[model samples]
Target: MIISVDHGNKSIKTPHLLFTSGLVESENQPGIKTDCIFWDGKYYSLTEKRISYLRDKTEDDRFFVLTLFAIAKELEYAGIKEPDDTVDVTLLIGLPPAHYGQLHARFEQYFLRKREVVDFEYNGRYYSIRIGKVVSYTQALAAAVTRFGELKKHASSYIIDIGGYTVDVLKLRYGKPDLAVVESFEQGVITLYNSIFSQCNSQYALHLEDCDIDEVIKGEPTILPGEVQILIRKMASQFLTEFCNFLGERSIDLKVSKCVFAGGGSLLLRQIIERSDKVGFPIFIEDIHANAVGYDLLYKSEVAAHGGQ
Candidate 1:
């Protein structure tokens, strides 16, 4: 089986399952266990709080363990509660274009454990899988695979992935990615969250959380003051303007190029972006798992290109 996983800084997404990237590790089993996995003599439980931004995910085993959880969830979704024997698996994963050159090789090797098989227990069910192969691809460009036909009609198009910790941009010239023009900006949704939190703390003396701001943006009922909520909307709009200006500073004209937006950050700022006259009629990939889906498509194409590998 070929499983594609998108390791976002905020969440871990597979074609079938999406979970927070946060993992709570403990030496002993948890007293109240739910969505817990036991691996390598350690117990891990999924949580809503995300891990800190990681430039290099393979610096530790956290992401590897997250991949285990992702695979287990995918298997369960496929009606495999517990495998009787080791299952051969080809894992498709990705990294941002900026980091792909330096990290893709190590990222691939990180999943290919020295042992032939990996065994773990998830939610009281045991799963054993052999890593047949691991393929890593560029992240932002992969999300734009579904639009290749439309993009090829134009002279150039830009894929703007507004992710959790970074806004990664990839240029597609004549429907093919120009790797030379890839850029990653540190200003992402998380950065916007921090900026809002800081302003609320200073101006209103309100200690705002990410969820609180999310509620305001989503037009959900919240206990926050109407004034604070208005402030959030205002700042969000300003952020969108600044983001467009940043692109302009880099000589990227959204009006001239077909700009496609993807990733979690894009969804969060969708309204603000759409309202901005500075942006053109932008295309949005609403599916948060678009990258994972693209990775799957890319892998099939690659296999077919290699004559069924």
Candidate 2:
């Protein structure tokens, strides 16, 4: 089966599941009760190793390793077992537009022909898979295709994909992507999440967990103090304000006839941005996994473009 993964700084998302992108490589094996992948005498699972840029992220080998992990989980999600402990499959993934040019070839070449063999345990089950053809795309543009399908191709538009650790903007004029005006920045949900994390930490001296952060972002009921609740609302307001300020100045929104805000951040930003009088409401921002969906939807076209059936 073909698999697509959007490896964001905060999460690794497959079609059916969202795995925390907080992987840590540990020397000791995890307890039997723990859910983890044991490979090469080390255990790998969600930890606090959140990273956005290449400088701070793991090396290329670790990327390949994580890709293997994703593949294993992908197969499990499909309810398939690896005969001979090796299953061949095609893979599609994306990179930030800013990093696309520099990193695309490297990632493409990483798993070109090798029948990658991986043995790992997920949910206490042992599984293995042989990695096969891997293709890559610019995450933002891939998303733009789905968010703005061919039916609306000719419309001038601005796409702002607010990811976990990066904000990728693409300006489209007359149906063609305007790379010259495209921009990506470090500002993302993690920025706001981290700020809120620190604010609660300093104000209450309480180290809240990721679940708590998730609740705060999801607007779920929480036991946090009323003052902190006010602070949470304030932080959300500031995030959207800064987001609008950045999008207006950074993206070519003034020149476009349409605007779109995609990615997980869209969910949180939508409510606040809509209530604001300054920013224009977007027409499309539905699926949080639009990139993966787009990749799957456009797979045949892409393969055809590459001279395949």
lDDT string for model 2 (1-309, tens) is 788877777777776666666666778776545446776677776655554445233355555556666777767678775445556678888888787777777677675536656666665667666566777877777787775554265556777788887888877766468767677788888888889889899988877665666566567889877777777778888887777777677544422346677788766667766666545646556777788766776786877899985
lDDT of 2: 0.70
Alpha carbon deviation, residue 208, candidate 2 (Å): 3.0
Q: In model 1, which regions exceed 4 Å deviation?
A: none
| Whole-model lDDT, model 1 | 0.88
Write model 1 residue lDDT over 62-105, tens digit each, in one string.
99999999998888888888989898889999998888889898
Which whole-number lDDT from 0 to 100 does residue 201 have in model 2? Answer: 91
Give all TM-scores, in the order shown.
Answer: 0.96, 0.86
Model 1, residue 46: C-alpha shift (Å): 0.6
RMSD of 2: 3.0
lDDT of each: 0.88, 0.70
